[model samples]
Target: MTTPGLAGFIASGEDSQTCDVVVAEVLEALGQGFELLPERGAPRGGRRRTWFDTFDWRLYRAGLTLEYAAAHRGGELRLTGASPYGDAVQLVTGWKASRPHQLRDLPDGPIATSVSGVVAPRALLPEVTVTGTTAAYRLLNEDGKTVARLLVEYPAVAAGDVRPLPPRLTITEVRGYLTQARRAARIIAGIPGVWPVTQPLLADALHAIGRYPGDYSNKVAANITGRMPAAEAAATILLRLLDIVEANVPGVLRDIDIEFLHDLRVSVRRSRSALKLFGDALTAPLAAPGTALTGRKLARFAAEFKWVGDLTTPTRDLDVHLLDFEDTVRTLRAAKPDDLEPFRAYLKQRRVREFRLLARGLRSPRFVTLTRDWRERLTAIRDSANAGTAATVRSGQSRRAVVETTGTLAADRTRLAFAKVAKRGAAITPASPHDSLHDLRKRCKELRYALEFFAPLYPADSYGAVLADLKRLQDCLGEFQDTEVQIGEIRALATSMLAADEAPAVTLLAMGEVTAWLAARQQGAREDFERRFAEFAGVDGQRRMAELLRGGAA
Candidate 1:
């Protein structure tokens, strides 16, 4: 489709001894065979102006133009142009920026020169007439001899088959046209009639050539023709690209910023959605990479890059840690001789670990890679869910049956995964890293709930009790896990500060008290969960529910 925009070129230069050199370079760059128009004199009323008869420059820019007339006077500059949507027309009395009188008064010479043309709007087909005009003015020095020259060109063409033109002009084309007009104006002004020129005509010409359709409009059209499933995909991609440009490469390129990392996450999400929406069009090679990168890789990256995301929370956590550590250090520093050494050692170790974790997270490659991978996995899962839904719908089963079947399958898979996690948890030794064991337990809870979502689809009498029990267990475990995490962080902070040799004795002692209290809290949470699970298991609810479902009871 023809993009609704316009493109053209303009060139202007001063009329001086150096004018020939500039004009020659412009013409060489623009190529040969462009027509030139006859020159004209300055406007009356001491207001200098010039016009061109005819010139042919390339259509390099197209866009809308706005015009306004001077309220005091009837005359105005008629601005005609194009934008992404349609043609533009503007009329104004004054120029955009005023020229210095000293520059304007360089002995009366040609005051202005311009070469302008328009790319036929999309509405015009096959054959369209392109018309342009150019004019020149001469300003005389006080001696009455020509000291400056001005040239302006209005070039218009009546041509057929211009429909084959590109939707927008290239940068090279626009630059060449401007160069030529400037050179040409300089060359013509050397003749006695032209002097005292302004470059406004050149500026106008450049603006005219820079007009063209915007990228958004073109991309939208392309996506529609290409049968993209979601209209938002193009917008999303564009936004993501803009984010990358603005964040990572605001001025100089190289090295990703924290903002860039965040933007990258957003882009991956949108790209994944696009891929799934247009899955039919995407080949395996294109889709497989996304899946492969996600999962384990993404999980690892999230852990490593955890610091950038941690900044807000970290500052707060650090403040609290510092305050407590400082109090403890003060106490330890002023403590009785019996407690001094131990307190000092503890303070020293804590600082080392906290700073180390902070420094490592900021520049970890593994973290970046894992983040990319996780995004890939998320997209893959979303795509798979969509595909699975379609397949189920097409299988000719009743809606209820289809839903039930899919739910059951999903629940079973989750159950199996979580069962493995629970089994692994039992083997976790006291020496095992807290994060590893904690993550495993968390995964178990996720699996349990993933199964519960399908409970309603199963025979109510059969799975109802099981679902309820699973939910109860999940809630208990979730709380327990959270408390555990808090305690870990608290302990890590306390230890780091103690090791730093900076925390006071009082701060160290207080942190120790807090750590002990949290440990007690953890014990209480575990005991509560244990008691609840024991009651659930002994009630025989699972067996009763199973029998009811198997018997086909409502």
Candidate 2:
């Protein structure tokens, strides 16, 4: 069956004058099953509009209610299911039918209308029921296909001085009037695009409610608060989804190419990580019937596709190449004019290649798909862990297991950072001093993170010394690295122009100046490193880090 959904925009005036008009229109069209949510003080400035305002209407004939709420803050109008506990199964309307009513021309007069029986649900959609003089209209599309039968009613009319209309024509006349009123309102107050105010997960829950026609309170709650005993069930489902996606990646990549394949891989890894992080929260609500299958399936998939370690290798390699290229440019620029021309062509070609590689690495369609897949997987993992049903003892054990697992991940992250730094540092050619220094700075950052992860586990004295030395190295290297990066860019640009046979003299001149500048910076970095290397590479530094991690002391 098609999903039941609604989409609309709303506008509110500062004085709340337009609010009454909007409400009257809604009441006249959808009936008095709607009520205004209590105003919660002045809205914070520049907040997005939410579906938490104005009138709610219920049509008992269809066992459904449409709750309309508007936020003037961001000019958002939300139309969602009115039932507080269940899914929005009974409401069936296409996108076109779900569009919001536009407010139109306003009379310079006071408007009063009473709407009741629109109470908030403790959870999920609100509870509402249509009441009093109601009328039903066969809503038709431009093609004259019956879209939906809208039942609207007004509360008992008190002594009013307005023109009276026949019962049969009440709703039809009101619909026409509302259509015009909404149009005028729009002219007076322009409508804005739907604002992104809610969390993605919450939005997903709302979507699910609109999509599935079942009791979805638990699902909604799980999504909104990320809390639910049955979260494991959802997470398990998510895991399955990931597996399905991952399984298809190779084939999809074959059709779409390598870029998307790479993205798919990354997505799989991220999804796995996210699930691992929130697994506990997800498994709390699931029963035994499918719980084991869920856990084992996820664990198995993760183990089978465990390639995060492998993927990091390429990332590290690319980083090293980038550093090498930077150093080459710097070195060439600093070289004497006699030595610059030949290297100029080489440097230009290399820079272009590097840029292309970097672009491909980042922008591949596969990568984008993988990223999305990963997000979904993570969500699922969290859901599963939250939903899983285990004995109290088992649950506690799982939590402890998760905590312990974090330590290993921390260690791996640290190791990767150190290794990358060492690799890049070693790859710095004489020609690419600037790129080398940039790599060095990156390495230093990784080292710092590593130290941070191990800090709590290290002895205070040792930790302090290591941190101080690392910091000193970073400070010295940082300055050298910045100059290197700048010089490299300058050298690269010069080389490119000379290679193209354009402005050879000017490019050559600029190249020389940048090269000399880079040489001085490189000399400074090397000298600084030589002086500090003893302290940084000493037993108390490198060896000590190893010893501490191994539960030993320097």
> What's each prediction's clash count?
108, 57
lDDT of 2 at 318: 35
**lDDT assessment of candidate 1:** 0.37
Q: Give the alpha carbon lDDT tens digit for every residue of 1-554 in model 1.
A: 11112122233334333444443444343233233222243221222222211111112233223222233453343334433323332333443212211122112212211112232111111111223323343333334433223333333222322111111111111222444334433443343322433323333333344422221121111111111112122222333333442333221112211223334333333333333232222222222234323334434433533434453244334433443444434543334434434444553454455545644644366545544544444456435434544665688645344332333333334445445554565555545565654565555554443333233344555556665765676566666675576567756756666566556766556556655655776667566655545433434743543453333212
Q: Which stretches of candidate 2 lie over 4 Å from their true place?
A: 1-364, 382-403, 408-445, 451-468, 478-492, 504-507, 534-554
Q: Report residue 451 deviation for candidate 1 (angstroms).
A: 4.3
Model 1 worst lDDT window (10 residues): 163-172
- Candidate-wise lDDT, in order: 0.37, 0.41
lDDT of 2 by residue, 361-418 (tens): 4356655555465446556445445434245346665543332233343345555565
List the candidates' TM-scores in order. Answer: 0.31, 0.32
